[model samples]
Target: MQESTYNNMNAARSSKRWDNWEGHRNQINRILHERVLKSSSTDFCKAAIFGAGNCDDIDLNYWLNNVDELWLFDIDLESVQQGIERQNIDTKMIDKLKLFQIDVTGLDKISFFNDINQMLKDSTPIKKVVSYIRKIANNLEVIDDLINHYGSFSFVASSSIHTQLLYPHFNQMLSNTKDKETLMREADYLMSTLVKNYNQLLLNLVKENGTLFIWTDEFELSSDRGNLHLLPQFQREILNSNYTFLSKFIYNFGLKGAVECNKDLLSKFPNFADRLIDKTYDLIYWIWHYDLTKHYLIHCFIIRL
Candidate 1:
């Protein structure tokens, strides 16, 4: 199976040194333990994380030591290795970390990247492009090698990858194309389809009564825009009230994609919330201080399947 071109592009764009994101890593680890690991009675014998890019957002040592085996899945395997090396994890625990170079979207199986490139080269009409996207999304099938061999995992997580499932590739493909309005409409449909399927794949990989942790980078706030400085106050108010405040903030800042990015994951709640252990507080929100310049609005759900 060919890897999606966008995955490789994403790997290249990731920073080599993760020293700056220590706080974000710690925050992620703390939440996983509090919300998914310690609260549950399930034994996380074999755990897997999709989109384990560079493994920076997670606590490698804790997972390696706790789980009987830790499976890291990403389209780029090298990033996983570099992550381990960066952490200076003990070599003994390293054996527990299994790596799978796989695309969770299964786009490669249908030749999505190749097809898009060919379509662009041929100057395919917007109508045909929309049709192609719908066809591929409808026929999508995610192949899991781990299940047949190792069976379902005891614990599973998706590391803020839902928004990434389609947008980057779509943008890369339509960069030079016309008919923005039509393409955006089709992109929304394709993304909705992909998110549903991707969510199912995560659930399928979990054993009965196993815990699944999923999060997404819902929106971005940048210091460059001068509003990131307000996060300290805004976060408290936003959380104190409902998320309705978020829309106002977005409008004030003229930030694009926040609403759609948030809805991408939030909309799935009704379908999947039945299995959620603590619906009252199952969803957790935080700020991922990505760097000195940018922070991401992140929300996570802890589901028991």
Candidate 2:
């Protein structure tokens, strides 16, 4: 099939899978709380979740307990709306949370850069290529306003890592266009933007010696085997670049099949499942290997600023 056709098919499959995965809301929450959040600092007051899917999870509620202000952004409007309607996520809190519909993949547009430039002209020296940081900073302003209006928070959290695999898939799908090189350049641009944005955001939000925790799935590695390289590149950028390193905990054994039938599916099709699972496992392993094992896997970093 042509690349466009393949991408369309893959996009359809991805959408369907996310819809199905939404039902495992509680399990995802449990894992995040048990693994990622329990060890985080108890001094955060404002929190934000980029790529906040159907924000109906227990982990979020835990943050809401301590967080005076919350911000949630996602590319899917329907999912965000559904979260509001079904999850009873406090319209009051929702008002404070500042939900935004943004496609992180679309951060390459010049318009986005322009917006970033305008927003951050007053604060710091933003790199020319790192315009995407503006959106993060803009989002932070919302959180900052909340902090000013309400009070300080003791915790901040995001459940954005669940869709890490989509970055490469989207990049690959787009690369098949006639403008493959252009698409690749755009992917690089987007990654640069995110790294800058994340770095600045970390600098701004994390208190002096404050902690930040990121929760994400692992998706690529040499030993585990996978075809994609997008996330690996991004992960490398994070590690190689400037960021205080912390710790990486591999919940490999903890991630049993989220569903009871998943075991049956894995048992029946071990090879296929192994291929899929290995890609994710290796990605996680690589990040943890390079960062955690190297004593640099600290998703939870402390900033002196």
Candidate 3:
């Protein structure tokens, strides 16, 4: 499957190392070990990681030690392949690894089941056309493909990929959508419903008794004036004196707007909250931090189920 233009850009972004790798990665790894993996009731031998883009952002040891067989899924296969090569992953782990190029937006679903490294290198516009033409696509094949070929995974990690599924389509709509009221009302409604359904579908796809991990950006905050710097307690703690990520948005619900961007997501979630899969707060956290780069505030949700 072909990746959207924005996704390709994001994958390219991961090619560069973080400015504060020591501090940023250290905190991230500590959270994976202390909050996520350590709290798991099951040691998943067979696992699948969604949005496993350039695995630079992940703590490799978590998968290497816990999973015997690992499946990596992403919009761009080249990014993940490069991630694996960059990590110098052991040959044994690579042997058990499977990769798939997929887009969960129902817009794009290309299965390079044989080799993820091989992808369609069409222009961004053309790829989007192909993807948009398949807007009603169902990705049940993604999980079924995994099970049929490699068997079921005990765990699924949707690491910051959900919101990204909507980026390209949302942009396309916004650009073409002329009516201001339509942009607010119609766009908001579409985004809210899509976000809710897309998220629930991921949970339903998991095998029985399987654990799922979902970490994503919740909201973005920006001030017209450049004097906003207040952050939540957790952000202050994890990134004490660190300025690596000020306001980087990865996965986002199609809830962007001119104002009330934060409350927009909250207001939308309530409409479909009842339809969501039941989840426990075993390891869940929320943070609103200053985005030094974009000069925005980011609300992030880190949860394990």
Candidate 4:
């Protein structure tokens, strides 16, 4: 698909619906603070968040208390604005942390347009066509401006919620393209943009020995309903190449016996009135013994940079 089309689709889909999974969000943040932040000596002064949904801002504020400068960037500017307001964070902090609405899928539009224009200039019809396409492609500047403004950060984080939504849009856009090789090439290019953006953010923001924390849903790795089964190699590559092992913890539901305990609580509170009671018990167990078993294998890792 053309870069312009992809960016519009990405922006539209992002605006429609996006949210942080509450249970998973808290669990990951807890592990990050306890295992990573507490152990590291480097005080994190700056942080950047991609897909900066409202809930995630709350999670970051709760865990990363030392962060003096916070940058929130997302394709959906309204969402970021809502997050800032909902969190009641100081406007000064919001000002210090620039927000950019950037689409990461438009890396080569300028070069492609310039090349096409130069090649077709002698033919009026071709020139007009190329000029139209160039206008469409050039709209990618919305995202380019984001990269220019934010530049980089010390800590960068993004949740898997983006991949699940964006990948299908990309796949659909490429499905009808005449050149299969070009379609695949574009797909790879977009993915590389994500990696490059993430890597550059990490490299620029993180101190030599700083940490990068990625919080993803446990279901992404589960066998029965997990997408991880589809790309086992890619999953392994990310874990192996990008991160160093620190510690893993589970949250929300407990490992094994804890699940059973939750089940029992549900049984006792079969009616709606017992909902709060059951939730309280589950919360207590999740906080205390979630890391002990394999059943609740919501993995949380602290990676050393």
Candidate 5:
């Protein structure tokens, strides 16, 4: 998707989701308040959330109450405005909630999608497409104007968009290719490059000793792949199992192949295990019943840097 189209897609999705997810919203707000905001010692002068579409899973009032300034970044401003309107925040407090429209992935800055669409339009061979993505991946540089302009924040959070950064690109390529295996390999490389740099961007946004809260949908559940009926049992198993055991369970249950993004292969993204302090971080999982027919397994990581 081009940046404009992606923003429009986000706005449409936000409108549909605006009034739903009450329980999910409360759960996410509670987790962040208890596990990140309350646990941190940084002066609550500034905080920010990337991919803050419609801000459904956040308690806007609480954020305003805690931070002297709150920044919300999404590709579209309409959705952020819609989110603020939904919260019914006091007019006085509205001053503290600043909004920025930007693509956090920097994919738009590099015209990643546009290049690929052009290649496909020309019917470029799959090998050349693969090489193109690799070239872009190797040369990728995160846009830093956010830091240059607004400086760092006391707290930084990403609202379940790590997977989304690479999704549209993969879907676009998939639509034009029959050799899925070859495309998957290149998409995997691109996902790694995008996610890793995105992670670093999150880190860069945080002030020293501040906290970063990253949550993402790591796997899916439904009748087709892993029976959703077995979800309860699977959740129970994970509760008692260590990380190693959990990895084995995911593989044994055939979940590794079914996820939108396989956790084990993507630097265990969002978990940011590589940045773990003393091998410790706050981690939690919950089910997002996307609708009557679909469900997602969401996990969040709380890292204090």
Candidate 6:
């Protein structure tokens, strides 16, 4: 990926997400309140977030009072800047806020630095936009660099980024290749390995005994009437994946049974249970019925450790 890919985000994308956050602001804050603030172990002096873009859903005031520093990370620096400005925070308060523009998944590292340089030099027609991504598809590798760099956080949170593991890369491959079926085939072959490695990366980012709160909206189910339900399943899927595969590797389960992830065959990464503080965890799977059609099953994991 180009340095530009590493540095910033697409303006349209960052703008649209910010707009979406405005409509979702209240519900997001409400959920954070219940899951994080209500938790007895939510206090921390400094913290880092992987998908802390726009900060629309982040609990700024809580951090302001409890934390001495708050690090906001995203692929888009502009979105982070918008979050800082939206807070209307004072200069002294702003000093505690540090912005990191990065794609935690590691393959997407083309920064705004690359984009600006390409424009200044007048590169090929659309190479600046398309080339970096094409390179990414071919250059993918296992990554666990978050632990090497910003490894520790008192409290870690994921804002709908886990299930999005392969989505962006999948989309980019579709766009660069412009053949959906071909891209799908490639994804079927490539994604499991990528996802397994990425999932490991996510877990390793947590500290040895820090609190982790992950809320993800994935898993869809359909009713008899043809309506679909978007349910949450990060923890369940992870547990199932771990149970299915790690059992085979570590416990030597029978090979007669079959299980799948994303309708693809399943394999396990390291189980998260080994990382839990007391292994006393709570998983809240509840639907946030915003309207008749826009119901989201929020998969909330309150893991102490």
Off by over 4 Å in 4: 1-20, 42-44, 54-64, 90-97, 104-154, 161-169, 172-197, 217-301
Provide the TM-score for each candidate, comma-separated. 0.82, 0.43, 0.61, 0.48, 0.82, 0.59
Mark the regions of model 5 whose C-alpha exceeds 4 Å error after superposition: 11-20, 42-44, 149-151, 173-181, 223-226, 238-280
lDDT (Cα, 0-100) at 189 in candidate 3:
42
lDDT of each structure?
0.70, 0.40, 0.49, 0.43, 0.70, 0.50
lDDT of 6 by residue, 211-253 (tens): 5666655432335324453233433544454434323332232
Better of 1 and 3 by lDDT: 1
* Weakest 10 consecutive residues of candidate 5 by summed lDDT: 254-263
Candidate 5 collision pairs: none
Tens-digit lDDT track of model 2 for 58-105: 344554654566667555555656555655655556555566555443
Please provide, for model 1 over 134-217, each residue's C-alpha lDDT reduced to its tens digit, 9 standing for 90 to 100: 887677765664457333687788887776666676676667667666876777777766776777777778787677787777
Give the residue spans of candidate 1 off by over 4 A.
Answer: 1-17, 42-44, 142-151, 179-181, 223-230, 238-281
Residues 1-305, candidate 5: write the lDDT tens digits: 45555566666663445456666677778877787777667565688888887787778987788778988988877877887888899787999988888876677777777787787778899889899889987988777867674336877888877767766655655675676678777876777677766677777787877877777766667866646786786567557645565445444542222233334324444556554545446666667666555666666677776
How far is each candidate from the true structure, as Cα RMSD in Å? Answer: 3.8, 15.0, 8.9, 15.3, 4.0, 9.0
| Local error of candidate 1 at residue 238 (angstroms) | 5.7
Q: Give model 1 RMSD, 1 decimal.
A: 3.8
Pairs with steric clashes in candidate 4: 102-143, 153-205, 154-205
* Residue 125 displacement (Å), model 4: 19
Where does candidate 6 have its weakest 10-residue lDDT segment?
254-263
79-126 per-residue lDDT for model 3 (tens digits): 788778777776666677888876654434433211211222222343
Ranking by lDDT: 5, 1, 6, 3, 4, 2
Clashes per candidate (backbone, < 3 Å): 1, 15, 5, 3, 0, 12
| Residue lDDT tens for model 4, 111-154 | 54344334444443543543444454334333334434342445
Error of 1 at 12 (Å): 5.2
